[model samples]
Target: MLMAKTAIITGSSCIGRESAIALSKAGWNVVLTARRADALKETSLLCESLENCLVLPGDVTDEEFVKRLFNETVVKFGRVDLLFNNAGVNAPAIPLEELSLEAFQNVISVNLVGPFLCAREAVKIFKNQTPVGGRIINNGSLSAHTPRPMSTPYTASKHAITGLSKCLNLDGRAFDITCTQIDIGNAATSLTARMEKGVLQPDGRRMPESTFDVTHVGSAVVHIASLPPDVVVPQFTIMTAKAPFAGRG
Candidate 1:
């Protein structure tokens, strides 16, 4: 019998949770991590094979915690085949001058620094393991391409993630490791619940933007994860067709 493929997914809510459930249902062993232990456990329980799902809750920004996350995954699953660099945070939407330095730093630490730490550890494992390669799928945002009004911190971090993904792909060529980014638009999740009311648009307007089901994100992730090793998708964008994105301003 073939050993099941393993994946470590950061963030245990919304996109993270849905991705875990989808991957679990697709026969991949999943390791879920996030700061909220309870949320992680809740996500794990929803997996198709509970026995194949592991929850390791902690802050992704902490170096030691990131190290432990990878260590524990190896101990449990023998090897990791994929890393979903999905944990992230967004600062309060405010003008650049009005944004607190603390809030900006917090968003950067979680959204950018956290992914860097995780990817570093994953590359180490991928390079040293018998298989000699793995894949990293980063959860980027549409903001990486177009900035929304008063979204400096979040936009900046996502833009940096695009650079990170490119670098990882270029550097991992020798090892057969691949990196891809998925830029998601408005997905109906708690984080975006306010969108049902209205959100600040670039034209100094507060508009109610359309959102797609979050489950689509889960399915997209599973599709990318299931791709053949020889194929690589550098960037994939998924968004609500009706969303005000094409002419967003």
Candidate 2:
């Protein structure tokens, strides 16, 4: 049987792109969206599930564009089965003292506002669709639990996502559109290259962070998507075993 009748993956950077590829491999008609058109094209070509993949390039930060993507997905695919709100960034990790208002707001816009808008639109679409339900998986961060030394904007936004996810899970019960959060730790990606060298530890010292392959995260996403609608995991954490997260302070 086909899994995820239809799927959407935002970001499509490291883990997002791989998640799209994996879900496409699982026989889901996938729609790949991001601000980069060329990258989306390249991603669409990298799938192996023999499913029709659409590359819709635009900013998730745009409310109109976000709604249009949702509307068009339902028009093209008949319904939306899963939405991976994975578009995010960690703007130059500097001390909070050095963070300008623009920098802080930009991170919040992309991480928090974008996800909020996307989730809202998805909820509308899922409710209106005949099945009256789907699934929304928010890409949260380990920072939602413990903050790093100088990642104020990223940390704050991720922590806020925890609350958003909780609300969605509770409110989505009636519609059968389950909502879940995946708090991921460091994975091997261009964004986390600094981990190979060293990163800030809880004690204010920089230490090298061991990273697991990005495929492990892809595997986790696949597992989350494979679950039956009746069995929803409200929150899940996927991280590197050797990573310094426990009591990370």
Candidate 3:
């Protein structure tokens, strides 16, 4: 029943791409952003039947570029109803001592700071729209709760995301903007290929992780988007049931 709604999915990686397609199918005009123009275009094709889809290729790290992305979304679709702050990166699995400061900063830049910047832009646009409130769905990871072995960069970034989401939920209240964080694990996608072979577990072990259909993530995102604006699911985690991410991690 969503009508005349628009959304932006920053860093439309595998999960982001799936989320974008789901939202588009649910009748939201979707703007896709990522580093590569070609990849954005490819993701659009997958959502082909959704005529309102547009691709805006750019790096989320650039503040001006992120601002322009929000501006263009409003220009093209009139107003933004949601922002999927899903752009993120993971460093090669390595021990904490082995992780370089540069690597840590890089992960924070994309996985954490980028969302903050995009959310700021979204707040401006939402404040100006006729229905002056919108939803922001952040793409968090399982690592935020319990990290895998030697994943300091990725884990730290996602944990920061948890804090950011909490801040947004409280601060966005006045603006009628609601923020929700989706913590996902081992969703079958190009980004998780290494996990299929075997992954480092917490108990000083290596085991092949279980996988789940990416479409499950796609449908889950849509379910959240379909909810009434007055309702907010603060945080939800979805992952392969058999995936060693629960207490077994």
Candidate 4:
């Protein structure tokens, strides 16, 4: 009998939730992780089958939690084929001088440190597994390249993510493990809800921004995850055509 491919999705919010459902429908056993049990359950229900979904709710910032997440996934599913390191958080919009250390640390812990822990565990599994290869898809933001007004913490963490993705791509090459990142901009999620109303612009203007459905992100992830082992797409950027990103003031 052929074993099913398995994928673990972190964050279980907006894009993560939609991607989990998309991958599950494409015949992947999915493990959903997030801090909210309720949200995880909601995501699980949308999957192709309850048996194929494992909902483990916990803070990604917790080392023990991240370890257990991988252990439980392996125990339930023989191997992990893909990891969508999608969990991330943003700091409050404030001047760098006004941004509290606590808030900045929280964003770093969740957005940067959390992915590092998860990637470490995933790499170990990929190296030891019989086939000895897997795929990692990181959900990066356009903030990695462009900075908005009063978003130092988020932009910094995302910039770090670009470096991480590049490192993983280079390091994992020998093991047949591929790392890819998708830079998203203004996806239609709660995180970007304020965009429709009006958000701070780089030029100190408050203007509304365009956003596309979160499912676009899900579709992009599914495509990346579906690639053959011999193929690797280092980085991809997806965004609304009209989003104020290319030539921001």
Candidate 4 segments whose C-alpha is farther than 4 A from its true place: none
Question: Superposing all C-alpha atoms, what RMSD in Å does each candidate have to the true structure?
Answer: 1.0, 1.7, 1.6, 1.0
Residue-level lDDT of model 2, residues 1-249, one tens digit each, is 543478888996788888988887777788899998888878888886435787899999999999999988877888888999999977777877888999999999999999999999999887888768888999998989888888899999999999999998889888888888998888888888988888877677888888878888878888888788888998899888886888532
Query: Residue-wise lDDT of candidate 4 within 69-165, one digit each (tens)?
Result: 9999999999999999999988778778988999999999899999999999999999999899999998888888988888888989999999999
In candidate 4, how many Å is residue 121 off? 0.1
Q: What is the TM-score of candidate 1?
A: 0.98
Comparing 1 and 2 by lDDT, which wins?
A: 1
lDDT of 2: 0.86
Candidate 3 global lDDT: 0.85
Model 2 residue 132 distance off true place after TM-score fit, in angstroms: 1.7
- Ten residues in a row with the worst lDDT in model 4? 240-249
The lDDT, on a scale of 0 to 1, for candidate 1 is 0.92
Total clashing pairs for each candidate = 1, 0, 0, 0
lDDT for each candidate structure: 0.92, 0.86, 0.85, 0.90
lDDT of 1 by residue, 1-249 (tens): 989999999998999999999999999999999999999999999999888999998999999999999999999999999999999988877678888989999999999999999999999999999878999999999988988888899999999999999999999999989999999999899988999899887778888888999999999999999997778999999998987778733
Model 1 segments more than 4 A misplaced: none
What lDDT tens digits, residue by residue, belong to model 3 across residues 1-249? 546688899865688888888887877788999998888888898884546988889999899999999988888888888888998988988778888999989999999889989988988887778878899899998888887778888888899889989998898888788888999988999977878787766676678887889999989888887788788999999988897765644
Rate residue 120 of model 4 by lDDT.
94
